[model samples]
Target: MDIRKLDDRLSVAPQITPAEVTEAAALGFRAIICNRPDGEAPGQPTFEEIERAAKAAGLEARLIPVASGGLPPTQAVAEMARALDELPGPVLAFCRSGTRSTILWALAQAGRRPAAQIVAAAREAGYDIAPLAPLLETAA
Candidate 1:
């Protein structure tokens, strides 16, 4: 698992397998948030498969599939925020390349934190979320 720690409460990564979900739980993650849509790539594990693994490992899982190469919709952002609010801490969120999940997190944090702080957090996590700074400011 190429997990990039974004903070104490959240981490992001590329596509993860069922085995990785268990590993994440073992590593102290309490939940899994999958942002990748099903069938996005050949051999990509379906959300159901990962969900089953999460369940078996006693971790909660939620799917908020964001289309590849596109920004998450407003509803998707809302859902992500809800998950962050409702789910247990130390959540692992993933999508292809982990960009969608990072973007969702950044957008969800817009009003709660300064745009610069959000961008800096994403930068620390190895994602260039500065492009969304304007959008974040609008909400901030």
Candidate 2:
């Protein structure tokens, strides 16, 4: 898996195959978050398939899908934050390009983290989270 660790508790990566779930477990991730809705792309694996794999690997899974580049709803952001807190440490979240996953993570941290901190973290992980600075400020 081409995983990018965004922080100690979270990582973001491109879509992962069900087969890769075992590998993720081997890498010490305790949970999986699928941000891409099923059928967003022609060949994208359904969340069910990935969930099955995650369960088999003894990892918890959550789905909070958002369309590509779509602004994450407040509820979804809240849910992401809850997942982060409820799930075990070192969770992995994925979308088609990993950008959406990173964005969602940023949104989840909005009020809890400074915009610069969140943006910089995402940037280091190869995602431009600067666009979210305004929203983060409002959230703060």
Candidate 3:
């Protein structure tokens, strides 16, 4: 996994394998958040498979899947916020291209940080988040 650190407390990556969970644990990550829903594409490992590996590796695991291009559900954003608050850090969240992971994390950070900062962070991490401006305002 090519992990991209979003900040001190969070990192995001593209679809990760179960083996990567061990690497993540070894790297001192305390939790994993899966933003990709199950069966979203052919050949993708189910979240349960990853969760099991994460658990065995002694990492908390959460699945908060969000569809591409759709606005993140309010509940999903709140869940991510709760995860950030409750889960041990630093956390590693992943999805296809790592875009969804970054997007969800950005949404959770909405209002808590400047929208420009959030967008810049995502851009720095190789994601285009200029479109999330409206949602980012919710957190501003």
- Using TM-score as the measure, the top candidate is 1
Error of 2 at 111 (Å): 1.2
- Compare candidates 2 and 3 on TM-score and give the better one: 2
- lDDT by residue (1-140, candidate 1, tens digit) is 99998778889999999999989999999999999999999999999999999999999999999897767899999999999999998999999998899999999998999999989989998999998999999998
Off by over 4 Å in 1: none
Candidate of highest lDDT? 1
Candidate 2: global Cα-lDDT? 0.92
Model 2: lowest-lDDT 10 consecutive positions: 67-76
Tell how far residue 14 is off in model 2, in angstroms: 0.5
Q: Among all windows of ten consecutive residues in candidate 3, which has the lowest summed lDDT?
A: 131-140
The sequence of per-residue lDDT tens digits that candidate 3 reaches over residues 1-140 is 79998888999999999999999999999999999999989999999999999999999999998887777788998998899989999999998988888888899898889998999888888889898987788668
**lDDT of each residue in 1-140, candidate 2, tens digit only:** 88999999999999999999899999999999999999998988999999999999999999999887669887888889999999997899999989988988898898898989999999999988787899988888
Q: Model 2 residue 61 lDDT?
A: 97
Estimate every model's Cα lDDT from 0 to 1.
0.94, 0.92, 0.91
**Candidate order (TM-score):** 1, 2, 3
